[model samples]
Target: MRIYLAAPLFNDIERSFNERLTSLLEPMAHVFLPQRDGKLMRDLVDGGMPLEAARQLVFEADINAIRRCNYIVAVLDGRTIDEGVAFEIGYGRALNKVCLGLKTDDRTLLPSGDNPMIIAGCKKIFANTIELVAWLRGGFLSARDAG
Candidate 1:
């Protein structure tokens, strides 16, 4: 199974989260993490390429990885979901790939309710790592075992 992990890679905390989750999932499935696989921007920037060009390199790589993966695990736990993560979820949905939202944030964007669009986009929104893991183990992976 291949999983495309979508998250903001702008800071240390975000990068660490991506790395930890990637490590957890790597043994069970192929996880394409943007921070790790889409490091072309950092590399190009260190090589003196313009920041905009480096950004484009990352954008192209991540989108292609999303299209290729069997599923997408999007991190939605912050003051707001990262725009890139939201776009990845939408693109994955458009591609007919399963989208799993990992939102551990207690903050709510809308007090009344979550956006219907985000609600419907994800097959399920997991509130924690344990919940997410149980789901991965109990859902499609089990189906694969049976088949």
Candidate 2:
């Protein structure tokens, strides 16, 4: 299986969490982690690439990766959902790819919880990484056994 991991990669905390999650899932599937696979916008601009060009490159690369993935695992942990992650989830849903959510954050934008549209986009929302890993492994084992 191919997984497109969509998460906020703006800071050390977010990037580190994404790397850790990728490591766990790597043994099970081919994980397309943007921070590793795609060029960072900041890096490109810092290296003398124009801001617009960097943005376009990053956008295209992510979109193409999403198209080729079997599933999209979006990290929905924060005060509010990341705009890029939200867009990726919506895109993945439009492409009929399986969309899973990992939200460890207790804070919510709404009184009830996360936004309805974001929740609706996910096929299943995991409260923690352990649950997500277990669920994926179960599915992987089942598939392997069946095959």
Candidate 3:
């Protein structure tokens, strides 16, 4: 299955996290990352393109990737849901695509109230990488069967 991976991408830690995720998923299926062009958007922004324009480009690219994929694996571990990731999840959910959310952050670390949107949007959720991968592979298979 083709899977669109959505996560925070602006930070160094996020870049490492996404790389690990890509490696993990590579053995199972095709993995699509928004910044697949080796920081082309970042380079554009650095070269004086407005930050807003760069952000719009990334968002549009992510949405297009999500639309092209059959499933979404969203990383929901940051202090808050990354806006782009949230958007991808919502789009996938609306399309009736299999949605799996992985949270590296502990529940106790999340701020006060539950994030109903994330909970409702994801068909499955996992706290660890292994569990998430297992769930995603299974879920993708199930989705294929249902379709």
Give lDDT tens digits, candidate 3, residues 4-32: 88877887888888989989998888899
Of 2 and 3, which scores higher on lDDT?
2
lDDT of each residue in 11-128, candidate 1, tens digit only: 8998898899888888778999887776667778999989998888878888889888988998888766778888899999999999999998878678764666776899999898
User: How does each model score on TM-score?
Assistant: 0.90, 0.96, 0.82
User: What's the lDDT of the predicted structure labeled candidate 3?
Assistant: 0.79
Candidates, ranked, lDDT: 2, 1, 3
Clash totals in order: 0, 0, 0
lDDT (tens digit, per residue) of candidate 2 on 1-74: 89999999999999999999999999999999999998799999999999999999999999999999988999
Best prediction by TM-score:
2
lDDT of each: 0.85, 0.96, 0.79
Pairs that clash in candidate 1: none
Model 1 lDDT at residue 106: 79
State residue 144's C-alpha deviation in candidate 2, in Å: 2.7
Residue 124 lDDT in model 3?
79
